[model samples]
Target: MHELSIVMSIIDIAETHARNASSSAIEEVELDIGELSGVEMASFDFAWQQATKQTLLEGARRQVNRIPGKAVCLDCSASFPIRQLYDPCPVCGNHLLDIVSGKELRVRSLIVV
Candidate 1:
């Protein structure tokens, strides 16, 4: 699955940073996953476990912070929460909206020791 590749990439990044920082090990990896990031959390977690099976991050914890979907209505100039990408604005019921969040998947922090 793609989550395996994603987890491998995360491990690579964490390893690089840990080595650069002269840390003995990685304690945790923090990720910001938006609602519309198209990633499966369970699959990601499983992939992470498999990816770090024999690495220094074998015991490292992954802390995922979920970011909610948000849309800014272009018609009403109002912002509201959305559960889907195509969801209309709650305030104005407008389909003309610019998505402001919930489409990102990024590493926010790394805890090494």
Candidate 2:
């Protein structure tokens, strides 16, 4: 699955950073995953468990912050929370929207020791 590749990338990044800092282990990892990022949480969890073995992040605590989807209606200038990518504006019911947030997938912080 693609989640396994994602997890492997994360492990590679964390391990690279830890090695650069002269740390033997990573204590914690903070990630910002948006609701619209298309990552299945259950699959990601399983991938993480499998990918982190024998790595610096094997014992690291993972903290994932789920960012809610938000968008602004272009026609009505109304802002609203969305659960999906193609959701229409709540106020104007318009299809044209400008995404304000909730498309992020990044490593926010890492605690190495």
Candidate 3:
């Protein structure tokens, strides 16, 4: 799964930060993953379990914040919640949308010690 690669990248980032901070281990990690970010949560969890072995983040507590999708109708300038990609604007039934949120995939914070 692509989540494995994502997890690997996260580990790289965490390691870089921990090394820069002169920390021996990462205690916690917080992530923000939005619904529209194309990540499968179940697959991500499995990948995380497999990827963290023998690393600084091996024992780190992880927290994920799920961000709900939101978009604005380009035609009507109306904003509404979206459940999936390419969802039409609820107010105008238009496909022309400007995504306002819910495409996030990032490491929000890390606690190293």
Q: What is the C-alpha lDDT of each candidate?
A: 0.85, 0.90, 0.93
**lDDT score for candidate 3 against the true structure:** 0.93
TM-score of 3: 0.97
Which sections of candidate 3 miss by over 4 Å?
none
Query: For candidate 2, what is the lDDT?
Result: 0.90
- Candidate 3 lDDT, 6-110, residue by residue in tens: 999999999999999999999999999999999999999999999999999897999999999999998999999999877998777999988888999999999
Query: What does candidate 2's lDDT look like per residue over 37-70, in tens digits?
Result: 8899999999998889999889789999999999
Question: How do all models score by TM-score?
Answer: 0.89, 0.96, 0.97
Candidate 1 regions off by >4 Å? none
List model 1 lDDT by residue over 49-96, tens digit each: 777998877998878889998889999989888888789878878899
Q: lDDT, candidate 3, residue 78?
A: 96
Better of 1 and 3 by TM-score: 3
Residue pairs with clashing backbones, model 3? none
lDDT of 2 at 48: 90
